[model samples]
Target: MTEAVQIRPEQFPLTRECPFSPPKEYRDLREEAPIARVNLLDGKWAWALTRHEDVRTMLSDPRFSADRSNPDFPQMVMGRVQDDDAEKSLISMDAPEHGPARRAVLGEFTVRRMEALRPRIQEIVDERIDAMLAGPRPVDLVRELSLPVPSLVICELLGVPYSDHEFFQAHTATMVSRQSSVPDRRAAFQAVQTYLGDLILLKEKDPSEDDLLGRQIIKGREEGTYRHRALVAMAFLLLLAGHETTANMISLSTVALLENPDQLALVKADPARTLPAVEELLRYFTIVDTVTARVATEDVPLGGVTIRAGEGVLGLGFAANRDPEAFADPDDLDIERGARHHVAFGFGPHQCLGQNLARMELQIVIDTLFRRIPDLALAEPVGKLAFKDEAAIYGMYSLPVTW
Candidate 1:
């Protein structure tokens, strides 16, 4: 038997030098070491999967466990212990448990449900844009448009009051930030969990069938399948994820389009082009790259490399979306490319549940923004804009714009 070699690997997740692009080192890694070992934040090492094919296969396979409670699970940072709330999150569960948990709430995010909510989403977009136009020139788009649209939508869906968005948004920012200390992250997690627990208790007293969380609560009580504690954790995950990820994408996608005028014109000329434009943007700005870490349950050879049982692997979604093997001229932002196969929202059973809603929201926002204000442009140079470099989710902290 070949003795497994142990060595300190190159640091993983090299800082994204370009705000809108993946790290240059990722391209080099994809070419030379598609499945190479690399160092993580906590001094531990794991195999980093850089190719789209390998990442898709690995994520779909049952051998790789998504359970955070697993002792052998590979962590992005060290010494971070998951609390009970973290353990019950659907994103952190494997099959059997993951399947039923996901199914229970899956109906809420279906295409029909999202379509029914489309008019409201459009209204919210217009309302925000109206306020932006009325108030001032060179407004911070992040605050004015990007954040509130989805934040309001998600709040309504989850039955959480949108007036308290600041509280949970602050907590979520700390939770996903790489620079946040372990204690800070834990505190953020607890704060959101407690808030959701309180809200769910109120819903239990007066459940509404129309609302997502209320529906889940009623079903959970009748079926006895979903526990109150588990529901709180689930709500916490949805509320944070429901707003943060889509909000960042909105800001990042807007900046990308503004920078590429020719592409922006395409979306502006024909409203029908907006859908594919959104998909291309999703592929190009594959933001949530680091969240899909998994631990191998058995020996698996991938991309000519063997990932041993008990080993850790990161499915680098940004690199995979940009892989030349998956899309022709992956670096270029082509609105017509229709790169729907991209892993921006991930793949397999763990694919984003709210993707349909996200897609519709982006399409409406982009189309409406450009149509209403054709002269819209960045207030400052793209390089000068503040970006969330230290956060796992790639996006701008603030986007100042004028029309």
Candidate 2:
């Protein structure tokens, strides 16, 4: 008889120092046991969903609640002051609450709306490319392009002054960096919250006809249902979630392309193929690994296993995208795999609200990069590229690039 396969605590900590790619153990575990108990830091246990189908089901299933208000819900980082309030955001709420809260901003992120922003997005991408070309050849893409393009775009969209980007970016960095101490992270959160709260008050005083926050404020005022705290929470959510995920994707996808010359050539030769390629790359490099955590509302059987009430489950986005059952060859980055069915943005009602904007940003960036710098390649050796292995969102600290 075979010994029951188990994921050792140290091997699979929430903060594993490894490449952005999914761990090989995930594939092994998915084949042997899709749903297995994993020991976390402090000897806590959480269910890890690895299979593609299982992950999809778990994400959409109502029984798997993201109610962060629950006592047993796993915290992103243990022992943080604003951890409770941070968890109460849309990502952590259950259906009835999560749905409407998400709907409030859905109109801004729809594919149609995102399409309308393409020209503006393209302009932003072009401006970044021009800046990169003007600067040092081996500049860090994270600082010049990956971080700024999305950062500025999100700022403009959310009605925040672009001049304040540096402060917000620093605050966001400290909050998301795993290396930061509890107090430091808490301080960062408080700073961002306070900053956004002030911004909300300003918007309330003199609202604009456009911009997401402005529109939200107007809607809330008209409906007479807007709570100041909710506005602050949504603003924080949009700023962090809107930019960070896409920024990581842009950097990671560019790295993946530079690594695979053939694929890069394919994309460079025919820019029309970028959208599908972006989809494939998004699947290939699922960076937000295990960031989405949900608690079991009640006893529910899943994937031939019973999950008890109050037990937490993590939807391993990285693992699920690489499930062999979901794709013909999960590891191979086939540009034409028609990977639209992939769960990179997740599934169900709580799917990423900014997915459209994300896709648009990726599309424009890829298109403009190839058009402007067809000879683009990584400046440093692939092995030498530094990854933020400890980040909640798997990413490269700096992607040095040259043409």
Estimated TM-score per prediction?
A: 0.96, 0.95
Candidate 2 similarity to native, TM-score: 0.95
* Candidate 2 C-alpha lDDT tens digits along 103-183: 887888888888888888888889888999998788899989999889888988888888998898888878887678889
lDDT of 1 by residue, 352-380 (tens): 88899899999989988988889999999
Among these predictions, the greatest TM-score belongs to 1
Clashes of 2: 1
Candidate 1 scores a C-alpha RMSD against the true structure in Å of 2.1
The CA-based lDDT of model 2 is what?
A: 0.81
In model 1, where do residues sit more than 4 Å from their true spots? 1-10, 84-87
